[model samples]
Target: MRIAFPSTEKLGLDSPVYAHFGSAPYFVIVDADGGDVETVENKDLHHLHGNCQPLRALGGISVDAVVVGGIGRGALTKLNQEGIVAYRAVEGSVSENLALIKNDGLPRFNIDQTCQGHGRNGECIH
Candidate 1:
């Protein structure tokens, strides 16, 4: 499966996962089966709070799923509608998360679990 991870840097699989998907500066996309990787700039990086255009931010890249530490209800809804599943990210780099993915360790974010906003520490406030 191909998974897109919101990253704070453009360090390929070694990039640390960003706290919020829409606010991430880069997206490191990895092809799980083949190990192909691509990093793209998040086009909508500066979007207003609660108004994340994920598709635009991802530069319209096609992928099976997205892994993020936090995401808003609207963004999650949009991704679900597009047949893209959003998995909650663990505290680690993209490479670490990939290993967990092999064992289905990450959890999916439901609407109620979505962030209403971000805290000062960049953590999602649900």
Candidate 2:
């Protein structure tokens, strides 16, 4: 499966996962089956409040799922509509998050769990 992780930098697997998907600087796409990884800059990083377009940020790159520390309700809904699942990220690097995913330790992101305009610390409020 192709998984995308919102990142603060382009450090490949070791990239630190950004707290909020919409404002993240980059995305690290990882191929779970082949262990390949690539980074893409987030095109819609500067979107206005509540105007995050998750797909646009991906720049048309197809990914099976996205792992993020937090995401807004609109972005989560958009991702669901596009058939891409979102998972709540664990506190770790892209590589560590990948490991958690492989072990089924990460929770699937749901609309009810969307962020409530929290700051960078990623404290999502229901």
lDDT minimum window of 10 residues, candidate 2: 117-126
Candidate 2 per-residue lDDT over residues 73-115, each given as its tens digit: 9999999999999999988899999999999999999888888
What CA RMSD would you report for each candidate? 0.9, 1.6
With a 3 Å backbone cut-off (N, CA, C), the pairs that clash in candidate 2 are none
Q: Stretches of candidate 1 above 4 Å error?
A: none
Q: After the best TM-score superposition of candidate 2, give how far the Cα of residue 39 lies from its true spot, in angstroms.
A: 0.3
Q: Predict model 2's lDDT versus the native.
A: 0.91
Best by TM-score: 1
Alpha carbon deviation, residue 47, candidate 1 (Å):
1.0
Task: Give the poorly placed runs of model 2, Cα more than 4 Å off.
Answer: 120-126
Candidate 1 residue-wise lDDT at 21: 90
